[model samples]
Target: MLRLGCDVRVTDTDNTDKTPDFLAGHGDQNCHIEATTIDPADNPSAEDRNLEDAVAKIKTLDSSDFQLRLIVEGRISRTLSKNELEDKFGKLLVGNDPDEVRRGIREMGDESAPYAEIRGRNWCLRGELQPISDAQKVEGGSRELLIGPMGSYSGDASREVREGVLKKAKKYDRLDAPLIVAVNVLDIRFDRETENSALFGKEQVRYSPNHPEIPAQLVRKPDGVFIQGGHKPRYTRLAGVIFFDGFVPHNPRGSVCLYVNPFGYNTALPQPLYELPHAKGVDGRLNRVEGVDVGFLLDAKSPFKNSGQP
Candidate 1:
């Protein structure tokens, strides 16, 4: 809001948990803004927990010369015993030549490429050893392992967005003003489609029983965050939702967009918020309005170049 030139103040709810984060005024218009974050999928099975526990133990291995990368697949029916872990991984790491492993690491352009492999009755583990710095070797630390992206699963972004919006809507129900829920989605899969599906409903094709002559018509299911069956609006207090995909203070390059709820009880927004890129529902159709990039408002140097990472 500081970037948008709004005179913002922290909201107080008499020490109540229902308070929103901020109240801001811009050009005679004002609204309550609540910020939230949707993290990656967290529903893990018992097998998943077992695998993670084993990985944590692997990270504690005492190897100074190389950083271990573990590519895991399949189900862990039983816990991997410490002796079995050592036999499969420890012996291999101890006998491997560091120079040979470094050359193998360079030869494989793909980061997922593994230099060694081990298997159990129901699972397979691929290991990649990357040579560490001489300084790191001297100052020994736990043999931390980097997890492969393939091993991590991010669940549906639409479900995540819906749950996030609903949770916030339920929190600040008594606030009488227009409320904007700003969400920072951490999942890489979050996109325009995800946002649309979460707010409007998942698109599907259906045929009306009374109008059999009519061709199959595309329609939205009644499962959106702000919509219910028969295109009825719900969560009317939510004026809009501001979406930021993986946007953090350190990295501001992520796309910023808004979804204005057509059914909101108090849909009015401050002047600065209206200028942002937004999409609105009109007669069940979404109309997207393009606006200035957030970076244009900041007038700052490139976020990537000035990131201070060497």
Candidate 2:
């Protein structure tokens, strides 16, 4: 059995004919747990309804502290808008950055009360989008980078991108969330000769990722720059790099696609996808084999720093 935390107790409530999934205890308090099975038919609105049902059931428990966890076959994609998701369940779940919420609530004049009390004492639940892979099964060494065409990177844009990435990483560092960089590949331009070609004949594009000095020739119209030689034509360049905290499906050829989890906050480039190298066989032709990777950033000092209760 996969255990998220030692204090958390997992039991099958199916035999009891209850919709609740399991029960957990925090100190002397008993928290009612509900595991909702979500499918394509169960959209955000449906999920919200399920949450309401779970909350109603949880309130009937002898204890006031209870939570609801949702387990699904895949990530919950395209259910609620960002504002809506945060509005309804922001306080209940642990976000990428607890400081942001604390600051927000404090700014609203609630400094006298701590966030933990507001979270624990209330009859609220934290929605966990439990993907197929539990935290334990997640592997390491699955990280990759994606750089866009030369024109996509605007003047001093790379610095901005790097800074944004670092900022988000710092915020989620405590929660062990991955850092993501989204680059727009559609805004890149090519040389006159390679402009109309399917294959990228530019030399600089291949080495853009490791290039120390960003080139000025690859500048785009209003702003932005691009990498010269990427995997595809105009669309072949790297759009972004996603640092996943756990195992995620990888399509090197950039074919198979899945949506990101909408429950928790994401810092990676918003909605943009990256282009990957094509799968090759002995004859240098296309081959079909699914790839998966688990990318995570490590702290030099303590690897198990983010382990245990939040």
The most accurate candidate by lDDT is 1
lDDT at 220, model 2: 23
Write candidate 2's Cα lDDT for 204-301 as tens digits.
33225576586535422211122223322221112213322212223112222221222223323221122221122235332423333212111222
- The collision pairs in model 1 are none
- In candidate 2, stretches whose alpha carbon ends up further than 4 angstroms from where it belongs are 1-4, 14-16, 41-310
Candidates' TM-scores?
0.65, 0.15
Per-residue error for 175 in candidate 1, Å, reads: 3.4
Instruction: Let me know the TM-score candidate 2 reaches against the reference structure.
Output: 0.15
**lDDT by residue for model 1 over 131-171, one digit each (tens)?**
77667677765645554524533334787788888888888
As a TM-score, model 1 comes out at: 0.65
